[model samples]
Target: MKEKIIEALKRIEQEFEVKICFAVEAGSRAWGTSSPDSDYDVRFIYVHKTDWYLSIDQKRDVIELPINNQLDLNGWDLRKALQLFKKSNPSLMEWLHSSIVYFQAFSLDGKMRELEDQIFQPRASLFHYLNMAKGNYRNCLQTAAINSKRYLNVIRPILACMWIERHNRFPPNEVQPLIEALIMEGEVKRELLTLIERKVTRDDHGFEVDFPIIHDFIEKEIRHLEEYANSLRGPSRDFTATLNELFRQVLEEVWSQS
Candidate 1:
């Protein structure tokens, strides 16, 4: 495993001509429930040469690296990331605060988070979460019976909506924090906790939570969020300009230091 990771890093450094600034396990393994035969969910960031960014044509902002039996490498384009930052993209925010760190810049991701307050647009963020909730609800909630992952699909987005409503900001991706902020009942809380634990203990056929009672509550929240989402207006032109500037800054910074 160690040799495979090192080889993966070397390939990115040599082939992409970018220093892998950070790397980490991002998915089920990082959260502590990976099966024996599970694949590595390696997520990382890279810095490239300045000339590569000087072109007028849009380049691939993010890179999804190839994987071997033991490793899978993927990364966000720093420019695409900053653009998302202005719109308050939750996944970018989660990357900054990911519990498992492969490599890190003390200042870079942290600085981006700080800039979020200045560039934050409530309308853009609301639309983002609402869209995500709708998509996940559509794909996962086909039926109540035999649909095990439906709760997480609904809960994640609803929690994001709840966070946006309460703090007027994006929600953290840590499942517990999202739940802790809203759900206070003992039995309901236990059900969620048990779901997480069961996932950890079980194999990857996808386990179910023992929460027949909680479906109605989740469904109600989803409907409310969908209704509220309809009223949000899109971001103003000013927001796009700010996002572009931020992205340019990130590109320059990465190129210079590379």
Candidate 2:
């Protein structure tokens, strides 16, 4: 599968005339809770030639391949990625911290890590995760019998919100580390472990009885995080200048070598 992904990336670069800087697994697989039939959610950041950005017209800044049952491959252009990074987009931040790496070239990861502390917006990230938890819970887990896989969607974001409130930074992308750091050795933690075990061992296709303990935990966290997120002040700095400079540096570094 790794080889197939690498070959596909190479084909994408040649066919589209871009250079892929970084790529990683994004969804349940990277979070360590993927089941046997889980698809590969391959996300990447790529750069086109310098001339491609020198136009007045708005060109597409994303590359998306047709999704199949086994692989979902797509990428963001470098400029688009940097713009999102400046805004501290939680999805982009998670991409940077993904545990599974498919490809990395140049210094994109190092450069982003150096600026992470300065650019991270805790308030924005908190609201993002909080909203995710709320929406997933309301949509997927409000019944007696629920899709068991939906628990991770709610629990992971809630844990991320907890991590942000406690540490004031972006949370880890994987759920295990977040669990270890935030949840104590109690019924909630035990229940979460059991859910994760089931998630990885079998395909999630049917509805099952919901875990009341997990439901209670999710409800309490959502209410608490809403209050905490509202208390945080707005972002303190404008990162446009810093990100602009970095964007130019990457264009120079990537194209100059070719």
**Which predicted model would earn the best TM-score?**
2
Total clashing residue pairs per candidate? 3, 0
Q: What is the lDDT of candidate 2?
A: 0.88
lDDT of 1 by residue, 28-72 (tens): 565444546667887766666767777998787667766668678
TM-score, cand. 2? 0.95
- Reference-based lDDT, each prediction: 0.65, 0.88
Question: Worst lDDT window (10 residues) for model 2?
Answer: 202-211
RMSD of 2: 1.8
* Model 2 lDDT, residue 214, Cα: 81
Q: What is the C-alpha RMSD of each candidate to the true structure, in Å?
A: 3.6, 1.8
| Model 1 CA deviation exceeding 4 Å by range | 1-7, 29-39, 139-150, 203-212, 231-258
